[model samples]
Target: MKTLMYVFIVALGTLACQQEKKIGYVDNGTVINQYQEKRDVEDKFQAREEAFTKRADSISKAFQLEVQQTQIDARKASQKKAQELMQGLQQKQQMLQQQMQFEQQQLSQAFQTEIDSLIIKVKTFVRNYGKDNGYTYILGTSDAAASVLYGTDENNLTQIILDALNAAYQKQ
Candidate 1:
């Protein structure tokens, strides 16, 4: 029994001497928000949204002016001519509305696609980083949700990963 106990102790010591698994956690929101590339993408999308709004506003203003002119002309024109003019204006308004809606949808879809791509890039970068650094796992936590409930400050990789990601983005 004593020999068996010594053998068990030796086995435990051998297992303890094996390599330790590395694990880390990062704040997903912080990393994504502080990432320079994400900020650049958001800025670019904002500019596009502003430009689209301006163009839409200009078109709407021009249409309003045309409607006002048509009303004035209708007052001096024949009943039939006034009816025709009103119908034309209505058709034009409908076409303009449809065009605006289509453009808005296209812009929204494009932005969503870009954002999805960026998210994928972030995930891929984290995976590669873990593989390269020999991390068994790299959990993510956010204010809205968390994959890791508790981790020591030493195991928090958010800042380090964020800095590396930003550097890589700058090089690109």
Candidate 2:
């Protein structure tokens, strides 16, 4: 029984010393940059931003013209009526300005949320890819040159990860 116990302990020790060899690494920056979905989202956001800017500019010009017209009418009225009209116009301008500011804030929040969500999606894809491929460990490298020094191109796996991520995104 003692001899059997010694054999079992030796076997265990041997197994422990043998590490899993199927480790892979990927450049996350390269994957994200090359991902078509990420590029599409960025382009869409840029277009939306440009549209918002144009709308804001158009509204500002229209509001300025209206305010100028109101001022002219206020100058022509009786003194007391002129003062009241000017005050009312000022209040309306303040309200419109406040509304515009609120809309801009909402837009900013929405854009930030969208970007955060996309990053989460990319992270999820990386996690799932690692799990599905039976990798013992997957390291993320931001520097391609450094990665090449440590990992072979066969183990880079960025293209595979990007492809899997896009496929998963499309399915979603």
Candidate 3:
């Protein structure tokens, strides 16, 4: 009985001596959505997307007009000449579509690349923030996969970290 009691006391003392873990959680969606740099990146891409749409629309309209005129010309020509004109028009349309698709791919790729880098940067920022502020762990929570299901408001660092991220971005 004495040995058991002594062992229990020793275990209690050892547990009491261990430091409490400092943990916090941030909502991944909140931080990323509210990040000013990410917003700016999105806005920049939006403008580019608009411009590309306008250019594509203008090109398509011009081509359509050309096609209409060719149809009118073909109506007054020999059947063989009309077929030839249609074949040429079909070729031009296919080439134009290919070119537009390529441009769209390029634009999409560039936007994705920038967004990807920004996410990495945010992750790095959180890691550095954790290290500098003495966090044992800073877990992330998202609707799709919540690493942290429930954290107290006092332990929620979403806004705190977002503010810091924006402040740093503003400085830049």
Per-candidate local distance difference test = 0.95, 0.82, 0.97
Q: Using Cα atoms with residue i matched to residue i, what is each candidate's TM-score against the true structure?
A: 0.88, 0.75, 0.91
Q: Which ten residues in a row have the lowest lDDT in candidate 1?
A: 12-21
Q: Candidate order by TM-score, highest to lowest?
A: 3, 1, 2
Q: By lDDT, who's the top model here?
A: 3
Q: What is the C-alpha lDDT profile of model 1 across 77-143, one tens digit per residue?
A: 9999999999999999999999999999999999889888988999999999999999999999999
Q: Which residue pairs show backbone clashes in model 1?
A: none
Off-target runs (Cα >4 Å) in candidate 3 are 1-17
On TM-score, the leading prediction is: 3
> Candidate 3 clashing pairs?
none
Q: Which one wins by lDDT: 1 or 2? A: 1
What does the lDDT come to for candidate 1? 0.95
**Model 2: how far residue 159 lies from native, Å:** 3.0
- Model 3 worst lDDT run, 10 consecutive residues: 16-25
**What number of backbone clashes does candidate 3 have, counting pairs of residues 3 or more apart or in separate chains?**
0
lDDT value for model 2: 0.82
